[model samples]
Target: MRPMLLATASVAVLTLVALSAPVRAADAPFNRISTFNVVENLPAGADPAKPTAAEIITYTEDGNTLIYSDSPGERIGFIDITDPAAPKAAGVVALDGEPTTTVVIGSKAYVGVNTSVSKDKPSGHLAVVDLATRKVEDKIDLGGQPDSIIKSPDGSYLAIAIENERDEEVNDGALPQLPAGNLTTFEVKDGRVVDASKKVIDLTGLAAIAPEDPEPEYVDINSRNEVVVTLQENNHIVVVDLPTGKILSHFSAGTVDLDKIDTKKDGVIDLSGSMKAVPREPDTVQWIDDNRFVIANEGDWKGGTRGFSIFDKTGKLLFESGTAPEHMAVRLGHYPEKRNKKGIEMEGAEVATFGDDRLIFVASERGSLVFVYRDKGPGAAPEFLQVLPGGVGPEGLMALPKRDLFVTAAETDNRKDGGIGSVVTVYQRQPGATAAYPTLLSVDGPDGLPIWWSALSGFAADAKDAGKLYAVTDSAYAQARILTIDATATPAKITAATVVTRDGEPAKGLDLEGIAVRPEGGFWVASEGNPEKKEKPTQNLLLRVGADGAIAEEIALPEAVAAQAGRFGFEGVAVVGTGADETVWIAVQREWKDDPKGFTKLLAYKPADKSWGVVRYPLDKAAKGWVGLSEVSPYKDGLIVIERDNQIGNDAVIKKLAYVSLKDVKPAPLGSEVTPPVLVKSEVKDLLPLLKATHGYVLDKVESFAIDAAGNAFIVTDNDGVDGTSGETQFMSLGKMN
Candidate 1:
């Protein structure tokens, strides 16, 4: 087989800086240990659909317990992390209003509670909860709703950002609304708040965007009791001395010029776009040291730069990261092309000193990843360490150096949306550690940029090479293409792509789901049919394409079988034999209208005879959703079939591999008087454990599975093209499957 050149003349090739990153391997790096779902902390008879979130998480003083805000549930949930590998629910403390942030001072947890009646009249309080009793001890009435709360390094003072946020729908989310936001500071004595010492520092006339309505989004206190806050919408940053209650300094967070960014949302990731003078509407701000700080330019109504910036204490620009981090996300296939308006959507940041390293973590809310970098002090560019998957919508991040741990609160609770609920993910650090994620990646194309690919629906291993494989993308994109992957590289890489063309042009309106390489040359592709709609309903098609990717033949289902078609048609294809005697097998995704309960079909066709035959395949019963087959690969004894349920996360019951032998097999011709025979299948491996090992909930699609030339089996999950999903792709190899 000839190697396909993935590089194109359109985009510049990008380097994998992460491959040779200057990582501090002397100590073990942080790797996810466990995931704790907030739903487990719900009380008995609680309405599960009432949407709860685990946002703004913080560790207790002892570092053994975690407290996270649950705004929708109107409570703060606790988790015992004494054993970092097995986190336990420590129960939740109910609150009168929505909790936005929490910080542990001694044995009491100070929480920012928002009790606003409406956008016009924002109201909230500072709720002090006793950790031992799991009850609110006191509630200090704050004049407005609170967004961010933090304590001094010495625990002598507490500062909060009274956002009094503007409603987005109100005049298209423009600023300068009434009931302006301000900075509030209070004195703390013996872990108790002094009510009389509470001072409200009016932070108006600071930013050029909306000087009157200064919406303070986040606040962080440095070692000298100095507070640094970010006004995201107004694109401003301010520094205030907590002891004197005096404004120390202020400046606009400013704009950034971004290049090599994918700006178009045209169903493809083309990193040739650029944005000039894009506002760095920062979200979260943190101090790397008393002399410098970092900002996550998440953007709001105005702008988003798709990167991070570092600035000196006096507002001097130190270092700028244009599109480097977000580009690395693209290398890992986490690029959200549909969300190109803001790029990766940088949302949060956290800084902490661990051992000999002062690490800074920048969170991408849309990409579901946290890019870790080592701060090289002031004036020098920080070195990129590695990127970690931050679950789904990792809104809040915290690093616990005292316990050598890192945690993130993923705020997206998709239970109501047929997805997994919110989760608090834990990661542990040990010396000389190796990274685990990004099991698969794409290498730089000829133009230096990584080859862009997503929605990997089907896989086929190279017949001659042990680590070489071919993958097909679904109709997520406009064109149908085949990707060649070299699994020999660390974190297997997609080296090239071939567009499946018809009459020398890219195929249109085709949802190709499966591919099987021909022993002679080229491939046999399968397109899953959708016959539910009346007009332009797709038909399950089997196409034969040559080595050049030009369509040689297109076969459709028989009239009798096509008449009883359902939404799910062909999902996977595998070929046995060669030339004229070559027999092609197709796996139907779900039970068709003609199939019986818990039974789908393994369809067979002969290229020479042009005859169609079918054999029944039994499915495992699902507890909540339907079960179906995803892929079919011929193994030594029989065919290895990927069987899974439509459910996701913990609701999933059947994601396994079932084998069926062809020793006594004879598929009856479809529409014939003879009875169709059922293949006897036995379970070989249960895949639930492998999916759970990633410290994320079980994904719904275990779509592609194949045995390589060395008899090594591999599995990959589809990310739905990162649309309304976390964009976390799992490509795992289970060693050899004999």
Candidate 2:
């Protein structure tokens, strides 16, 4: 196979940095333990359709309970994590307004509530709630829309960032349209707030940009009662003494030159793109120690540099992550191509000391991942640890070092779009457990960039190699390509990629979903089609591809058979027999317009005669959504098929492997008026247990399955290219099928 040259010098440098990343062999790895859906705690009788989100999260002082602010529901939610692995719904405290951030002190929870009627009239308050009773005990007027709230390490002071946020629709989201946000602080006596000690410190004229409207976005407190705040829109950082409300130091958050990033939203991840002097408008800041802190350059208004940075109290740049984390996302198939302007959009940061190591976690909102790093003290580069799958759009990161657990609140609830709901995922630091994720990963190509791949819909095992497989990408990406996977690796690695080409150019309008190695040589790939699509309508096609990835032939269905096709078409393809008896099999997802009420067709194409035949396949009765076929592979004297329901998460039910015998059975010719013979099938394995093993919400797309020469079977799921899904691909081995 030839290496695709998609890397520039800058990209190669970034890739090299990732290739040589520090590895701490003795350190324990964090693995996901459980997942909790916020909807499970929804108030009784409340409309379930109303969108709810877990934006900011914090744990109790004892680290046995979790409190998260739900902005859409106008409430604060609590989860009892006494068992860590089995979190329960503790209840919720309803606030009259949107809850921005929450922090717990002793038995009480301090919540920043935004009651703003408009962007210009930013009004909010602090709601102190009794955690045991789940009741609001007190409310103190904050005088503006509050964003981030934190407490000093000694619990003597509380600092709130009064973000009089700007109205983006007014002037292209430019700054300087505010009531001028300030830092509001108060002295803490015992476990209560001293209302008389409320102090509003003016933060104006501190930043070089948008000095008049300084909207502080996030805040963190140090051991010395010093507060560090980030003015996200202004691209500035400020440090203040909590005891005297005096400005300690302040400086611009600054800009960086970025390379090897996908900057265009053009349905492709081209790492050769570059940008100069991109603003690092840091969003979340957390102090790693008294003199240093880390910032997530989320870049809300103008720039999102796609990485994080560490800075000292005097605003000195300690470390810049550059494009390393972004490149990691590409390697793991977590890159969000639609959000190219921000490129993974690093948005959340958390720092804590676990055992002997101070760990810094940086989260990517678009990538649905969290990059872990071991802090190496002040002004030093932190050692990169393994990254974690933080669900979809992870917004809140909280580390409980004492409990050896980490939590992330994913804000995206894509249930309406047939995706999963908002979830709070828990992970534990196991001493010697290998990372359970990235079950499949892509290695760097000869060009130095990772062989970026995702949306795996079908698989074909190598005829000679037991641990080798070939996978196909669906329509999630523009250019269709075939990836080679070495299934023997701990986490199956994609060793190479071959782009399916036509006339020396990457093929277009092809949603390649199935692949099968031809008995003679080359491959036979099935491209799923949708006739209802108004733009560039496609037809289901079976292509004969050469060993070099070039198209040798394009075979379409007969006109009579093609006319009956609907949105769903060929989902999987396989080959059986050799030479004169060679035949290609295709699994049609869902039912065509002419299919019977509870059955779809299994297509048989004879390569020798170029004739088509079909046998009806029975679909399981779905209790909720529609049932469909995902994959079909030839096994023994029969074929194994993956049948599943369209429901995701807790609602999923029918994800299974079934065997259908084909001995002595004949398929009717295409467009036959008589009823086709129904193949008898027996259940092979229930896939629910394997799908739930990773401890994440059950994914809906269980699309690929294949059995190798050694009879080893494997199953893989398509992430929809991280579109609405969590970008988590579960590539697991089902051991031997025979």
Candidate 3:
């Protein structure tokens, strides 16, 4: 047996686990302060339903405003961050073409507008707009499509990557398709471009993979007026001197061998896989100093190393992050199991200095997080700082050290799926402040790997332990398992995991949604089922699970009653009394075919007599979407139930805890045709305020609630296992319920 770790199982997991300890004055951490929805900045007459995104972001010299490119909206959006804690929509500047990237110089914003007629005939221009006037000042044609643009530290030069990007549909997106790309540069004086100084440094015939087509992806400039470019598809890096417009050095980004990673997208987080010599097709590049730079290995084409790497100006490999960041995401429950081929998919990078400390921030496009690290200078190891949660598909990272702030642009909007939309998330660093997010985490198992867990749908407190609880994962993963949680820890640590097994193997086709501890040292769990599922229909079931996690018995609804069940079946399970009076109760999520409009079922089964009964539970009216019961637990003299709407973010409502008295009320027979008596309920707590206090978004599933032996009440939200979600689990204590 492995010793339980109060913090993390391994040193590498400290990136996220370190938040479990107290923070010192010097180690003051960054915590998210606010989120600004991009839709709020849409133009006056534009359709509000149209999707918008904050792809690439930059700030003015005063750091009081943010400018981001909204490619889908074909515009540039602004945000007022004068009060970093409360970001407001300043407005948006409509453009003729899609904006790819934007950079601010003095009081003007320079944007790379892609007006490509076709992949074979790439065309774009640099649009310069006066920030104060909000008018386009000038547009310089570059004769190609621009992907990334940047300004020199000395404010004397601007560099752009003319990426004549290839169409993936064209010959399977193979190289040498057509015209090649080049490095475009211009001299700047007093915030205006010197057009006569325009120089195009051909980047063709350089990469070993495709000498004829070099698709320059990202570019960054250092203080010395030197630009670093990453040819992503070609798997190469190039260094160019701005003043001379000369290509000084270039090198292959190369390949890396990865181990202990999840390689399949089979609805499981198995990290025992390996990849041999995979391409490090890098994306964004940033300079830590004049001597070294870093690249996010996004692996857009064929390979992704699953991390970032550092290189010297001469193309010498300085450091490779390997799988440390991926492991950190796993511990934080941010791992994207559906897109496991590239893991977290590092796609954005930023470097800045705050006070006396230099920091490096890398964005995970798929994981929806930004990884922070302290740069220990060149040739030394960078210390992993902490990870920050973003909205969804965080693509751009910017650090405002002067204001002690960091901002991320999440480009993926999920409103069509009833999820969160694209937004700019802001975080602030304060002295002696601890990390406020990641209220839950998983520790290392006996195998020395962080136990992967998410979609926490049900919870049950220990019979005697004050701070110990048990939780169950739902259909988010293929395998159903019960996890042990130490609520005493600052971020409630998941200490151990036990697979819910049947016949000596992991249980299959189980969506365990609710759990309750039994009086005789076992557990009663409810598995929600959907008969409408065409692939493999499932039936709602009640399982008697021993302490060892093996199923001892399974109970199903009678055929006559089960025939009336809908897709939303059993959601929560609870046990009451003992011996002959032991009654197992299950909460049905929504109205079945035979139920009344606003009423679902609360099933009761007596193990002594093998009899079943049912009572009706009235559901509150939803402001929008549908309202349903998510959980039920024994409380005081009645039951505490979690009722919520299926809406997310600002549209969410009805996430509340309600109590119902079961004193003297008798249930009708399981298959009775008569209307069952309804249970009277009263609102105990409005959980919306607690969910909003997290500063991310109002998650829809407030699925678990339980009270410990010491009278402490806890609530946890299910993240749906990072599938089409931000992968954020909010585990909080409601204190003692009155």
Across 56-175, the per-residue lDDT of candidate 1 in tens digits comes to 999888899999999999999999999988999898888999999999898899999999999879999999899888889899989999999999999899999999999988999887
Which stretches of model 3 miss by more than 4 angstroms? Answer: 1-26
Decide which is better by lDDT, 2 or 3: 2
TM-score for each candidate, following the candidate numbering: 0.95, 0.97, 0.96
Q: On residues 533-563, what C-alpha lDDT tens digit does candidate 3 reach at each position?
A: 9889999999999999999999999999988
Output the lDDT of residue 408, model 1: 94
Candidate 2 accuracy as lDDT:
0.89
Cα error, candidate 2, residue 534 (Å): 2.0
How much lDDT does each candidate structure score? 0.85, 0.89, 0.88
Cα deviation of 324, candidate 1, in Å: 1.0
Ten residues in sequence with the least summed lDDT for candidate 3: 1-10
* TM-score quality measure for candidate 2: 0.97
In model 1, the worst 10-residue window by lDDT is 1-10
Candidate 1 vs candidate 3: the lDDT winner is 3
Best by TM-score: 2
Decreasing TM-score order of the candidates: 2, 3, 1
TM-score computed on alpha carbons, candidate 1: 0.95
lDDT of model 3, residue 689: 91
What tens digits encode model 2's per-residue C-alpha lDDT throughout 642-737? 999998888999999999999998889888776778999999999999888888889899999999878899999999998988888899999988
